[model samples]
Target: MIRTGILNPAVLSLLARVRHTNTVVVADRGFPLWPQIETVDLSLVDDVPTVRQVLDAILPQYVIGRIFAEEEFRQVNSPSVVEALRDHTGAIPLVFEPHVEFKRRVPHAIGLIRTGDSTPYANLILESA
Candidate 1:
């Protein structure tokens, strides 16, 4: 049995399958579900396991190359969310795209892990390193 890191079997298995350059989305609860892409829904309740919580668990397990966020994230989300994102990402450069364009790219992601964060525009696309 796994003792550390992400204990969720589905999430662990999905992380193992992701390859370099592959895109995985850590999305907020309200993000649209794409039928063509695999979704690992981890949302329990409002702000249960937040986007920061999931990222903290996953970042150590995966080598992320690039992080993408909606252009409106700064405007829509709380300052704490932004600070948490910065704290976790550190040196990783953040790229911002329009929400429409961000949604347009969702179908191309290998998977989306939904979190219970109620913050608007909290979704992020992580490109595997």
Candidate 2:
């Protein structure tokens, strides 16, 4: 049996394989869970398990250096989300990028966590450290 949070099988597998500097994605439901990238589908419904919840759970144990999100989220003034992240991990610097460019980055990520969140442009790229 697992001893802590984040017992999701797929998530555990990805986290196990990820090494320092490897990039991972904790994405909202709207983002596609591409087969090319290792995917952890935790979505139950429209908002079953949010991106924030999943990220918060894993950040405590994972050492991630950089976290990148769609540039749109920065423009939306979603400081609460960013603030919460600071509690668990170091600065998750926000980056603004074209939507197309953002989507293009996911497939190359070492892991992709699909959440049930509905927030716009809520995909994030987390680099392991």
Candidate 3:
């Protein structure tokens, strides 16, 4: 029985399998689903559980080495959204690549977490340290 930390068994299982340098994706609701990767869909409704909320939950439990995001995230999202994302990503090096390049990396990820966040290009790929 677990008393604290991540309580979701599916999420726990996914994180447990992550090795150093491995990546896991915390994606927005609109992100495309990849058939090759394992996904734990937590989306309930529009913005029910946001990308930030999922990041907040997993950050404490996971040792993240880097964060990969789409370059269009900054261009498409509002200033507040960008700032909020920055707050969640504190200290972890963030790399922005083209959206096409970002999707190209998804198939190799350990797993995908689907959140209800509607923020444009809010998806992130977190690499284990």
Candidate 4:
């Protein structure tokens, strides 16, 4: 049996299909998942598995081109979460897009990892590198 790397079957499936410059959305629990897009739901309970946590595990395995998150999340009064993201992704810059725009963009994502994070609009669309 497989005993190394990603143990999550869904995550492993998405990771296998991800390629350079491909788009993947690591979104909040409430983020809408389009029928046409592939979704990897890792959420078990509220804040059980954070969006950043998921990225940390997946990003190292996959080469990501860039990341897109809501502009509003940057101005968050609680800087801890954003700071965690900054620390997690490092130099990979985050592009700010409106909420509607974020939703519109997810449908085109090659894969979407839905997290249980309750943070406001804690959604990130990443471009495979």
Better of 1 and 4 by TM-score: 1
Q: Deviation in angstroms for 77 in model 2?
A: 5.4
Clashes of each: 0, 1, 0, 4
Clashing pairs in 4: 21-128, 63-129, 64-129, 65-129
For candidate 1, what's the RMSD? 1.2
Clashing pairs in 2: 71-96
Residue 61, candidate 3: Cα error in Å is 0.6
In angstroms, the error of model 3 at 27 is: 0.6
Find the candidate with the highest TM-score and give its number. 3
lDDT (0 to 1) per candidate: 0.88, 0.77, 0.94, 0.82
**Worst lDDT 10-window in candidate 1:** 76-85
Question: Per-residue lDDT tens digits of candidate 1, residues 44-118?
Answer: 999879888898999888999999999899877788877877888888888889999888878888899999989
Model 2 whole-model lDDT (C-alpha atoms)? 0.77
Query: What is residue 7's positional error in candidate 3, in angstroms?
Result: 1.2
Candidates ranked, most accurate by lDDT first = 3, 1, 4, 2
* Predicted structure 1, TM vs. truth: 0.94
Distance from true position, residue 52, model 1, in Å? 0.7
Candidate 1 residue-wise lDDT at 38: 85
Location of the lowest summed lDDT over 10 successive residues in candidate 3: 79-88
| lDDT for model 3 | 0.94
Which numbered prediction scores highest in lDDT against the true structure? 3
Model 4 whole-model lDDT (C-alpha atoms): 0.82
Q: Model 4 over residues 27-98: C-alpha lDDT tens digits? A: 888877578988878899998798878887777688877888897787763788778777887888778888
For each candidate in turn, the TM-score is: 0.94, 0.84, 0.96, 0.90
In the range 27-87, model 3's lDDT, one tens digit per residue, is: 9999888988999999999997998899999999999999999999999888898888888
